[model samples]
Target: MNRTLYSGLWWLALPAVLGRLWWRGRKEPGYREHWGERLALGGPAEGQATIVLHAVSVGETRAAEPVVDALLKAYPDCRILLTHMTPTGRATGRQLFAHHGERVVQAYLPYDTGSMTRRFLRRHRPRAVILMETEVWPNLLHACARMDVPVVLANARLSERSLRRGQKAGAVMQEAARAFTLVAAQTELDAARIRSLGASNVEVTGSVKFDVTPPASALEKGDWLRSHIRAGGPERPVFLCASTREGEEVLILDAWQRLADKPAGSLLLLVPRHPQRFDEVADLVTARGMRLARRSQLDLDHAIDGADVLLGDSMGEMFAYYAACDCAYIGGSLLPLGGQNLIEACALGKPVLVGEHTFNFLDATIEAVGDGAALRVKDADALANEAARLLRDHAARMEMGARALAFARRHRGATLRTVELLQRVIR
Candidate 1:
């Protein structure tokens, strides 16, 4: 519960952690060695203050992009280092911020061993470390605390599952959180969770994800997708199953077929969760005897009369895809993975129907439901009927879409408030 205990565990766990990292380095491509890390922290390159932001994966990395961009602009003399836990997130970060990367580098978070954490801290010598979301590694936090590097946790959300796990490891995790000089939580519940974890200087700062200024290209792409799929006819209902995990594709496909009799030209757009599974998903679609067309191959501005299902295989285009659909089923929630962000779809003005197992985005889901921006379904059958009815009534769909957009707009400034408090942690 104190610094001594926290650092002691980190010391005892160092050997096992380093051994695992060294062993796994042989199997993982992005896990290769980084000598530059030593240089990165030894001191600032020239006249820049060092700042490190650690985000576990793609979603968190994306959530921090605006903040990252804003920070780089605001602190012209500061060097920003972004660390990601997953290869996918690293790749996305590299692509998204290629220009800033020279000064703003991206790297894997060093394994949570005292030595590795010490070495990482010594190398990057981050003047400040801002941890994104909920990664509370003991050794690293202790190392930062020892070195007096201010650590701030920002845009944090605590779901029931994560909170329970944190409580089970309450002693260490609480100390780890306490090492931080500041904590910016996404909601009131999150602020309480952090405080209960022994995190002081905690502030409720909404969700930065709501502050995303989606690029201009999303509208262009959305319009193209809409006209192409509808074939220049009346506005059609497209039941988009977004970020679907493995095996959920079949249930979604089945649901689409179940609604076949309800409409004349309704369509389904299926987007699997990962880019690596694009080919696999395409194979599954054809194997299931469903006709399909790829988004890249079709001219979205025109019309495509041949496709029954449009596969959204492109990466970084979810905004456009969400915008193109009339009604959507946010995946992960339905097939039991606890769900993806329906708030994003709603932010783009699409009425979303989610499955009952949405533990991750419970608050956002509840708020959307209360606002009439989203609908909840138990399984494939209910999802099908809900889609059919919404699709049949254009006016109703439009109204729901308006409500969805309005809800998104209402939750806008969490990121700014989060950053304002976070600045205190650094100084």
Candidate 2:
């Protein structure tokens, strides 16, 4: 009743709705980039898929890429439908799977209302639906169950905060989750939470993000990085500020503040998670009384001497940057937003440093730190100290890095497990 009333009011507020979407499109550069696909509806149709996959944003989408590729190889006739709630996810999907996108259609997901959900269900008519991460839209799930579409939650993770909130929305969340045939969660903790949300068929399948076949562009990234700043050589170590978020900026700047007193020729690459914040972060960096240079404009052939910091003002190149560095400071944890996938840095054999608040990646971080694969800094000073120590001591860095790489390789095969689970539903 409430949903119907809200949706009815939503239609009445169409003008405001359209205006908001318009402003949103303008604000997000990625939305502009993907306007062609959205306008063209360039992906596969509803009947074209035996399975449908919806990922909310870039991280979730990236995690699903391996599963999609595996499914494509296994089931030649089944088309893949990829949907995203965020423009960045759409843009990243378009770029990552450009040639195959004609088969793997991309679009903004329909709003999660009964009518819209039903329209989407009927239109796609997929054999199974995979909702990556923990995106659970109540109306959509209800529609899926009504249509008898076998739904699965792949790489599912439910945060403590979300679980507490779901406790309040307990009835609704549980009802929605019960509609799903199974949920392949990332960890035992995740599976426990999903079961609490009323998914009886829940299973822990590990995280598919860990199992991605490294992109062919990996070597090119290393080459590009080597050309710019020589590492494992006579050059001063290059420290990458990988994926720092808003609140972490001051902490990062403080880290840089200490580094400023060092002799010339060291570098800090500040890669903010969102591309929209590049200019904002860059402005902040400039205000700190340090020289800033954009990564795109760099003469990589020359050495980076006297360059204070490099604002990694681009997207889809995180893995490349990770491969081409001495070590990195993973972001989000520094602020309070749990943290992002440090496994990317680990895969590149880069020792990682994080702030104290890491409940988001609790399992992975703990395992890695326990295995000496990463360093956890309690505060800003520790972050700076660890980074400096890692940079200066080649043997110590490599040992930690080697442990990190081994940890990454050890955790491989989540994609296989996820694919195996999907086969049951698709068949």
Candidate 3:
């Protein structure tokens, strides 16, 4: 489709988009609270030399953290304008960079319609635009090009399925890809795939997630929580099913029940990917006859003492969860939902397990397995079995954890490399 058609279609979908925000706000009020920014109706930063960075949601936003800090240090005079589509992402941005005050600006990126995007660009007058990962939009790119705003797709990756979709779109995707000033890819394979999709200046800058360091405060908090739980009785292993989606929870619960050999007083940390599903997941946990303790309701003292499962229902605590767990099963892979990031777990020196489907993080998963930092299981049952076995074999788990830490440390220069690339455009 051409620009006009694409913009028209986006305009047509505005109601559906707003309706989605309203529906999602039933569970997360922040979705409904940011209507003006979502419509590009919010006033701009009101000055020149602003840099705009777009990260779609929590994962991308987290990955963009190091880069945001780097940009702030590299260009002190320029304000960093961070935009995100989800409430969680916005909240995360606020927590990570709010210390900078007005030097860092946070807002919802307007919907990818022609007029809205154009207005956003004209109003903000950004020196450069950087998009985290493979979030490409025809109208946004076209408007950026028309406004002479250099666009960079940083930490870019293109899955096989995504490449196929781009191929299907033919000219539209090709033209959109061409509009980018640079595509700083995570891997050579990602660079090749994006190049095949018509991105001209593609470079393998590696994955910035490797550069993320778990906060010392989170580590201390997790250690305290773990010690308190152990103080209640003998030590019990904590197995985290991190970032699980809707369909996969049932499978996990089934596996949890089938694992009759699980140690007494062991805790299962079930953290759903979406906030909206917390209540639904809690209900599912109770329906399965398992006692649930929500993190939101729990204090550091005795809250998790006798709970069969701990629902990580709070936000901005993923690293804490990773540090608290003995073993973790990366979620979103149990079904065909690709996979969530295992980098945090690895960085925390936690042994990791994954299910069969991991197309979203294919290269990273395979590399971790090759590095002996992670293992791939066939299904939910295998995931449960492996987690239990790892918990039992303390020596083996320690070895794997050591390898995980080593693997993470070896890939720590991506953020620096990505900043070097962005400097060219920012200059």
Candidate No. with top TM-score: 3
Which of the numbered candidates is closest to the native, going by highest lDDT? 3
Candidate 1 displacement at residue 376 in angstroms: 0.7
What lDDT does candidate 3 reach at residue 415?
A: 89
TM-score of 1: 0.88
lDDT of each: 0.79, 0.78, 0.89
Better of 2 and 3 by TM-score: 3
Worst 10 residues of 3 by lDDT: 297-306
Give model 2 RMSD, 1 decimal: 3.0
**Clashing residue pair totals per candidate (backbone < 3 A):** 7, 2, 0
How displaced is residue 280 in candidate 2, in Å? 1.4
Q: Estimate each model's TM-score.
A: 0.88, 0.91, 0.97
Tens-digit lDDT track of model 3 for 251-343: 999898999898677889999989889999999999999988888876743657788898999888889889889999999998989998889
Better of 2 and 3 by lDDT: 3
Candidates 1 and 2: which is better by lDDT?
1
